[model samples]
Target: MQPVDLNPKRKKENPLVWIFEPLERDPEYSRERFFNFQAAYLDGLLYLAVASGEEPWNGLVVCTSHDRQAGLLEAFPVLAPHPVLGKWLYVSQRDPEFETVAHQMVKLARERDPRMGVVPGKRKRSPDVIEMKSSSRKKKSW
Candidate 1:
């Protein structure tokens, strides 16, 4: 994982960026774990986007609180591309507007990226089978 550039002076700073640095520093942290979590999260978000035809990031809530919100917002701008996902990070700060924005974002993403909205078809099932048992004992040979 890359170091999160938290310098506010940078034109493209993201609020969530700070979390990356700390997560990276953890001794137990592993690339496989990180990627696994990232893929799962992204996949779920993508699934939601495809189902609702909306942008997944728009659903994020930044957790309202003067200090917390500011810190996160300053570090992770909604418009900035995510380091791992390479997509804009949406910030809501626990506001009700998050759902609306997220839904819209999903829609926009589907429109912009064809691959993002394509859901795979379900697999086919085998036909059911049944066997009949002899109701009566076979007639004694004549």
Candidate 2:
């Protein structure tokens, strides 16, 4: 993704477009059964951040709906310290509003330091499957 031009005028021209690059990539990993679990986990955190009135720069977590018909969306905070940026950041799967929040985050980062750019890092993959074993039956119990 192109770096966001922090100039107010330029930012206004396309406030959310800069986030597209990061959002478009496939997630770090994927598992079919755990998709909702992953989304809900991230969403829960974002909700807390929004409710707490924490600065978005502290890091934001966003979750998009897996079900096409559900249309659900959520956001939260990530408390982990950024390796180089040294600030908390929200991480989430790609979604329609990713660009909007990303633009805002870029603006916030610039406010802290003009030289700071998007901190490149590897994405964490979600597990692809969960195995649940059925309890063995005892003949006596039956």
Candidate 3:
């Protein structure tokens, strides 16, 4: 039996990491795991993500504002509005032009295209979870 390398450094990288290589060359570029996806950011603005999961989410998520959607769509018709999250556009990995569009997006991002990214929204805690935390902090009366 082969022993798996328990060393964290040797862990397999995300398969889609290469698609964002253009932006990775910049000092401001950053990457993080968002939910089940791999999100790429430039100067803290999320530009795109590699979502390799179930259907709708199994592709690239181009994080742009509504006003810019039309232009991106016009430029790359292979992309479309995400089924569940209509606000963001998506390019399915199953699409034939996925690789081409991915490269083009990375190029635009590398050039610091104004329409490529958005200021990520802060994640809000659930009301019930906050209430539970507050209750736990209080001294219990018998």
Strongest candidate by TM-score? 3
Q: Give all candidate RMSDs, comma-separated.
A: 19.4, 18.1, 3.5
Query: After superposition, which runs of candidate 3 have C-alpha atoms over 4 Å from their true positions?
Result: 1-13, 135-142
Tens-digit lDDT track of model 1 for 72-110: 345334533333343324333344554454554344433
CA shift of 140, model 1, Å: 66
TM per candidate comes to: 0.23, 0.21, 0.84
- lDDT for residue 97 in candidate 3, whole number 0-100: 93
Model 2, span 21-117: residue lDDT tens: 3322434312111211212111112111211122433233322112311211122222233233233334332335544665554343323332222
Q: Candidate 2 — which residues are off by over 4 angstroms?
A: 1-88, 113-142
Per-residue lDDT of 63 in model 1: 16
lDDT of 3 by residue, 14-87 (tens): 68878887776799999988777789999899989997777898889998878889988898889898898787
- Candidate topping lDDT: 3
Clashing pairs in 2: 29-125, 31-128, 45-76, 46-75, 46-76, 58-88, 59-89, 59-90, 60-90
Q: Name the TM-score of candidate 3.
A: 0.84
CA lDDT, every prediction? 0.33, 0.29, 0.86
**Rank by TM-score (best first):** 3, 1, 2
> Residue 86 error for model 2, in Å?
13
